[model samples]
Target: MPSPEPKLIAGNANRQLAQAIGRRMSMHRGMQIGLVDARVERFNDQEIFVEVYENVRGEDMFIVQSTSNPANDNLMELLIIADALRRSSAARITAVIPYFGYARQDRRTKARTPISSKLVANMMVSAGIERVLTMDLHAAQIQGFFDIPVDNLYASPVFALDILHNFKGAMDEVAIVSPDVGGVARARELAQRISAPLSIVDKRREKAGEVSEMTVIGEVTGKKVIIVDDICDTAGTLCKAAEVLMDAGATEVHAYITHGVLSGPACDRITKSKLKSLVITDSIQPTAEVKACENIRIVPIAPMLTQAILNIWNGTSVSSLFDTATLEPIYEPLYPGLAFE
Candidate 1:
């Protein structure tokens, strides 16, 4: 017996990505869901308004919105849509956020500061989101911020497969490099799967858009280096790290980032950098400027997400879809009341 399809909804942020995901899911189970034009014009006092054209009563709803460009607006749109679905008697509402925003600000660096990621998580919970499905969050610990079931999908398997297919014979000579020490865990996982050596680029950032110097922590000399990261905002660190790797006698330097939130001259910098290639996921919609870059390549993850969604919907194990080398499957116990609190 086939399971009932979940309703798909899309907001203004990254409509094309949402449609792609919808099409992938629809190939198995049909859906009548469509994107509603969520464009809003500011009033004199500055208030936002939204309208949804589809009926979602008694249905399992998934609001697809990526907090990418105009992150605040996209976040608000998602929140409003969730609230609307809750009010419309939806059985379940899952926030399908491919690229979660404000994830970098998970902690307070200064006194009297707020943890923005926690606040966003709280907002989603308050907005009546039953679950969250996001990919390659900037900080993995951000999952703890949400009270709902949060699934953090990995884009590495997708990229690793693409790399193996497109850049064949280079795996032996290649070394997966982490853009920073913080991303060592992620890079190591990718490297292990690809059967390549691992390296790290130790970089110091004085401020936003500026990196002082970079040091290679492993033997990358004469090796093809592939830097992995969750997000690339300014491209400053990535380009600088590529420069350092090249100067350290690397044969070539490439980068594979999950989310290309390439704001403000990021594409331009990558185009002018020493990076051999820059591969990023379509988690965030690529702008015209990003599309114009010759070195940029987008690897699709829609098929992966669609399969996971189907597995979950059919009461099958979704974790079995990926090759998790070192990362353990963090699942909650079903029998929680059996003596374990």
Candidate 2:
């Protein structure tokens, strides 16, 4: 017998991105790809509830959600949805998270602090998710927190294509920069793709949400610097790094970040910063303030995500979607019993 049709479900967190992904799937497959009818809402006392009206028994289910702002609420919604699907007897469930929340707290920094990312992973596994598909995780090692198969996609392919089109004929004068030492790998990949030089921002962080000092490691003199990172939460690091690069004689600075969790005064800071433009993917839905920012531009990742979903459905290797040399998929299971190999 043939396999059941793939079903795409969206939560309240990022309906726009989910719809875009559906549209891309439809365009590519020449068929209408509709989201399963579901209701995810809260009661008067802020109690979350979820209901899946359509039949999904024995179907390959993909739940599209991004645990962004109001992270706790959205996270609960996803878990509830997964539980509902599992109870409904879905063949397989994949949590398609474009932006995984609590990813920054992947490790225990303070002696008594919690590794919240691991807890979140455990919660998902307990909630009945069999597999995970996410993009641009804050920390790559967070995959180990899950016992199930995890496919961490990269946005470098999308960013590289955009850079080529936007900076055509001027690639020689461009330089890819990592905002801090931690992001050197991400920056270097983009640099290699564009055949440009690479630079690093060596910084000292005195406390959370603040950078005490930053030093540029390489030459940005007379170059159009492009800073690449995974997330832009408060915009503090990007803005400060841009200033430092400019002070060191860089002609212009732009940032290509995957997740734009532009909370607090991020938009304001970007407006007042020395950066020419902030390019972010539509992994997390942009707020009105972010959409209205004159210096910010959004590139849709719906097409890339749609392709990944299709690969998963077809039982093909999703890693082949990206350049293997630059963006390798983490297939080795970090936990013993959950190995995909």
Candidate 3:
């Protein structure tokens, strides 16, 4: 028997990305996947309501929602949307969460704090989510919290292609630096991809989102340093590491981060900092100030995401989708219609 067509239902969070994914999928696969009509809106009292206009019975559904800034609201919307699809007899429901909220709370450091990542996983499972697709989760171990299959996509292939193209002439002088110890593996992987040196920023945080002092652990002096990280919330770590790298006689500094949760003076800090540019993926929707920043460049994840969806639907290995060692043409243009600032 022929399988039903796949559909993408988007929540308010990162709608642009969702739309881009839908369009890319259709364009590349001859209308293989489509954007479904749905209303995810707020009531008069600010309560959420979702109504799927399409008959999704026995359909393969992918719900695109980013549990970003308005964490609670976005999370609720995804859960409700999944519940609606499950109730409508969808064959399968995969939650595509580009930016997972509560990911930072994977483990409890304090006495009373909860393992919110696990809690979110439980909520999604209870809401009838059969699978999860997310990108560069705050902690890799967050995947273990879920009972269902989880695909934690990497931004390295996306970042690597961009770096190879942008820094075409300076690969010999380029160095990939991790902003902190936690990101060493990510930075190291990129360094290996582009055949560049690796560096790490040794820093101590007084509290979350605050960096006190930093020291460089590798030979970054006279090198064009590229700091790699998963999330850039306040832009504090990137800015601080850039400053410390400059103080260490580094030639130039740039950052390629996966999720740009640029909130609260992040734009201002990036503008005033010494870093040449901060590249980020559109995992989360960019705000007005984030779009207005002169030094911030956004690389769309839609093409890779479209390919992943195709791979998943075709029963191909999604794990083999992201690779940059050969530096082959991953995608001709990262984002077709989007302009990079």
Question: Which candidate wins on TM-score?
Answer: 3
lDDT of 1 by residue, 228-315 (tens): 9999988988998999999999999989999999999898899999998999988888899988999998877677776666665566
User: The CA-based lDDT of model 1 is what?
Assistant: 0.80
lDDT of model 2, residue 168: 73
TM-score of each: 0.89, 0.93, 0.95
Model 3, CA-based lDDT: 0.87
Q: What is the C-alpha RMSD of each candidate to the true structure, in Å?
A: 7.6, 6.9, 3.2
Best by lDDT: 2
* Residue 321 error, candidate 3, Å: 1.4
Q: Write the per-residue lDDT of candidate 3 for residues 232-291, one digit (tens) a residue.
A: 988877898899999998999999999999989899999999999999999999998999
Candidate 2 per-residue lDDT, tens place, 1-341, comes to 22355789999889999998888788767888889998898899999998899888889999999999889999999999999999999999999999999999998888999999999999999999999999989999999999999999989977877776677778889999998888998889878877889999999979876789999999999999999999998998889999999999999999999999999999999999999999999899999999999999998878678878989999998887576232222211211132111
User: Clashing residue pairs in candidate 3, if any?
Assistant: none
Clash count (model 2, backbone only): 0
Q: Rank the candidates by lDDT, best first.
A: 2, 3, 1
lDDT of each: 0.80, 0.88, 0.87
Candidate 3: residue 207 Cα off by (Å): 4.5
